[model samples]
Target: MAELTTLARPYAKAVFDAAKDQDAIDLWDQALAFAAQVAANEQVKVILAKPGLAEQRKAQLLADCFEEQLPEALSNFLSILAENNRLALLPAISELFSLYRADLERTVKMQVSTAFEMTAEQQQKLIDALSRKLERKVELESSVDQSLIGGVVIRTGDLVIDASVRGKLAKMANAVGS
Candidate 1:
């Protein structure tokens, strides 16, 4: 994971710089998403690892796949990855690129996990609470986890609020142990 991040960092920075300069953040995001999807596929991974395949052929395949959707700059970026045999890092590159974009936009992503599925009202309430706490607009991604028993666990980047029953129990146990 560390190596992947190391390999992806420069590419992500370059893409971010280009996107910012051209005012094409959305275009770069879409292209990166497509490239990431391609990289995640087993067949594409196999093809990318094949030493027999020419760099031009790989780039052509990428171009053909994204002909209508990708802009020229994004397509050329994909070609650069293919030439350097760095296509496998597309997913990591996309992740890093998203982080950079979020930094630029002053937005944060929050993961909210609850014991049960939340209704629209519940979700909105959580979002409102998080926005008030974080003092920023929060983009929430929610999930259901029966293991939580009750309450919710909210994670925003490195910070986590584990309010679940299980977490509470664990905390109590730790206190007793200490």
Candidate 2:
């Protein structure tokens, strides 16, 4: 995981820069996502791993897999990856590129897990508060886990706020132990 991130950073940055210059952030996002999906398939992974497969074949196969949906520029980008034998890094590159896109758009993704469904008003209020607190456009994602018993667990990037009943119980147990 770390090695893939290290190897993919430059490529992702380069693609992001190109997208910025072209005013095509969302366009590149869609293209990279499509390419990443192709690269992640089991049969495609096997094909990419074959040393005997020529670069042309690999590029063609990927382009065909996308049903030629790739723009000319992205098609060329795929050729570059093929030439550099970095096709396997597409998934990491896509993930990193999305981070770049989010940063450029001044957006942060937040996830909330709760024991019960959050009302639309409550979700909106939380999003509003989080936007003000984080100083970024908040994209709220949420799920319900009945085992949470009550309250919520919120996560954004590396930060987590564990306010669930289970979390409180664990903290209480720790305090008693201490």
Candidate 3:
């Protein structure tokens, strides 16, 4: 939700800055992803909602949820979140942290869906084009969707290029119906 995003942004920025300074951006990204998954567990949700539970207990429960012990910096960050009663904001924090990391690294991830699998050459070409267009290094992930009928659909964040035959037919059908 918007409120959670607003609440999580500062924490994410703080994590990003800290990780960047330490040259541990990748490590922090992995840590946040794991923490976000832990915070999303149903049992954790129940515990986090318990008003009478102390902040330390909530933080401890979160730490215990992780498969392994958190690193010192991440543990300290989690403790701060617990102290602020913001342990529930981990998912939003992870999401915003990822965005900040991507921006810092000048990387953009894109998806290409088509009716048939693409050759490596074709995939590389798509990646090159997207890198040039977006002015960022592009990671192109390919998927086959028979329902696409033909051609492809490229999705990058909020932007979608619907070049698939299915998409074209749908547009034509809408035009004719109108």
Best by TM-score: 2
Clashing pairs in 2: none
- Per-residue lDDT tens digits for candidate 2, residues 39-157, read 99999999999999998789889898775577888889889999999999999999999999989889999999999999999999999998999899999999999998999999987
lDDT-better candidate, 1 vs 2: 2
Model 2's TM-score against the true structure: 0.94
Please report how far candidate 2 places residue 81 from its true position, in Å: 1.1
True lDDT of residue 121, candidate 1: 98
Query: Distance from true position, residue 62, model 3, in Å?
Result: 1.7
Per-residue C-alpha lDDT of model 1 across residues 17-76, encoded as one tens digit per residue:
989999999878878888788778899888878899997688777667765856678778
Q: What is the C-alpha lDDT of each candidate?
A: 0.87, 0.92, 0.91
lDDT of 3 by residue, 1-178 (tens): 9999999999999999999999999999988898899888898889898999999888887888678777889889989999999999999999999999889889988889999999999998988888888899998888999999999999977899999999999999999999
lDDT of 1: 0.87
Ranked by lDDT, top first: 2, 3, 1
Error of 3 at 60 (Å): 1.4
Candidate with better TM-score, 2 vs 3: 2
In lDDT terms, which candidate is top? 2
What would the C-alpha RMSD of candidate 1 be, to one decimal place? 1.9
